[model samples]
Target: MTAPRTGDQRLAGRTALVTGGGSGLGAVLTHALADTGARVVAVGRDEAALERTAAARPGAVLARQCDVSDPDSVAQLAGSLADEHIDILVNNAGVPGPVAPLTEVEPQDWDDVFAVNVRGVYLMCRTFAPGMTARSDGDILNIASVSGKRPLAGRTPYCASKAAVLGLTTTLAAELGPQGVRVNSLSPGPVDSARMRRNFTMEAERTGVTYEEAERRFVSRALLERMVTEEEVAEAAVAMIGLTGLCAADLDLSAGMVAR
Candidate 1:
């Protein structure tokens, strides 16, 4: 076969599975992966949202509904796709827990956060990593947050879960690297997503400031003084997947939150 043109898609001939592919950064990542010429399977608990993502990409994306935190669900999805060779897996499903001091946070609230952020990544890797061993070459990108590296006050649960994700990524990298599976975590600080906008609104109300002001203050803390965009995070994800030598490392896109 002739070599692809330089302008051709970078991820041509690859197949990708993105968890949390329904909304926010997840949806954007799905679009970005498909644009790179990969056949992407957008998996999430929200079937409608997954379908919407797929509709936007048409044939490039296949929408599948599966809750990454649910063992049976993950297993079922993995079983169905057992025969397919998956080149990339993005564990992006996550939840931002309530903003409050750890002392006041409910036990259940903490568990809920861990269920989605930590347990979700674990289940996905448990189900999919074995199959990837056959190929001995694939990418596993866990969508962690900078808060995991640098603790964020008033978000103990989120901070803790993401920290666990970072640890999980490191350990998994060691366990899977010899098999040729590159495992890493992509930790983005604060992205200008719809969910983040609502979070800004909450801060605005609580701090008695305008939404714009709250958002401005939020981004001002970053070295770039701006919120990272979803597309930027997707670009980082693409870059992480393209690298074969890098594993068990974190690709931070927090604009400098962790740096500070």
Candidate 2:
């Protein structure tokens, strides 16, 4: 999935850090951000994957391995990058929790999801917001999901965690707006990626439906009747970062999912 080129260096000279930047949509975002002439730090738990992502953009994108769910790891990451002021932070690290009913979900599984999806964002913001506040400039984009606004049966943990992210983004925007730091979130619908494929496969098995049928049912809710592409989400992230006045906004790149 190739992101459309803008031929514009809007974010030139900016330093951006993207969590979960090793693979999937995160990798796409890292590339997109680098294309805008921003030096990007791609952080994730997988060293090999992060290396591959950084290899694509060479010097423009640096790969770092850090588990966002760990406080010490996040602190260490912040310490390592202390010399460079991060102008943009994309909290894209998240996990799709168990695809089962609430009763079938284990407490630990729920905690694990929150650890990455919710706590991870909190930790990143807590660590980095102060620098932005002191400088009086920065952009924080939290990748959320449409499942938070609508219903995704049997995905309580994932849904709840994303909903929390929306709340966090808005409140933080208010808290930090006066200080000149912009906080916002991008909520994309079921993106066409390996993650969603796994989700559809699980849903099919759980509901006794064919994989195609399960996927169809999920996309049917969107007015576009299709899953959003990774490129679309990445493009939206770049656009949000460039939009200076856009703060406390939950940009729904969900193919009209919320409308439906």
Candidate 3:
């Protein structure tokens, strides 16, 4: 087989499975992967969204509905895809959880966040990693966040769950390295999305500020003085997947948010 070309065709022969691929950043990543020549399986709990993603890409993207937080669902997904070889796994399923002080946060809300952000990654890896280990050739990219390292008040569950993902990615890299499986994470700062807008709105209400002011507070933290874009995040993910030597690493796409 001809080796895949670099740039837009670097992933021509690869197959990537992306969780949370139905909408938002997940949808963007799915499109990016397909544009780069990889056959993509876009999995998430939203059937309609997943269908839309698949419809957008036609034959290049396959949509599957699976809740990453549920083991049984994930197992069924794994079983269904057993015949296909997945060269890349992107654990991008996550939840923002309740935006409230820890004291005011509900216990169940916290669990819900971890269920999708932390436990979801674990379950996906547990079910799909063995295939990679046996084949000894694959890449696993966990979508973490800058909040994992920086303190984000009123987002205890989200921050903690992302931090856990960072830890999980590092340790999994070590365990999978000898087996020729590379594991790494991508940590992006506040991306300009509907989700972040909602966060900013909540912050504004919580702090008695205007929405624009709340947004400024977040942007000011980054040296770029702006929020990252979904395209940037998706591009970085593609780059990470193509970097064969990058393992056990956490690449920061946080717009210098962690520099301080």
Model 1 lDDT per residue over 1-260, tens place: 99844322547788999999988899999999999899999999989999999999999999889988889988899888876788889999998878777898999999999999999999989888887887788889999988887756678899889989999999999999999999999989899888788778877876788999988877877888877899999988888787767899998898887677
- Whole-model lDDT per candidate: 0.87, 0.94, 0.93
**For candidate 2, what is the lDDT?**
0.94
TM-score of 2: 0.96
Model 3: lowest-lDDT 10 consecutive positions: 4-13
How do the residues 106-179 of candidate 2 rate in per-residue lDDT, one tens digit apiece? Answer: 99999999999999999999999999999999999999998899888999999999999999999999999999
Model 3 TM-score is 0.97
Tens-place lDDT per residue, model 3, 102-136, is: 99999999999999999999999998899899999
Model 1 sits at a Cα RMSD from the real structure of 2.2
Model 3 scores what on Cα lDDT?
Answer: 0.93
How far in Å is the alpha carbon of 252 misplaced in model 3?
A: 0.9
Error of 1 at 5 (Å): 9.0
Task: Mark the regions of model 1 whose C-alpha exceeds 4 Å error after superposition.
Answer: 1-10
Model 2 spans with C-alpha error above 4 angstroms: 1-8
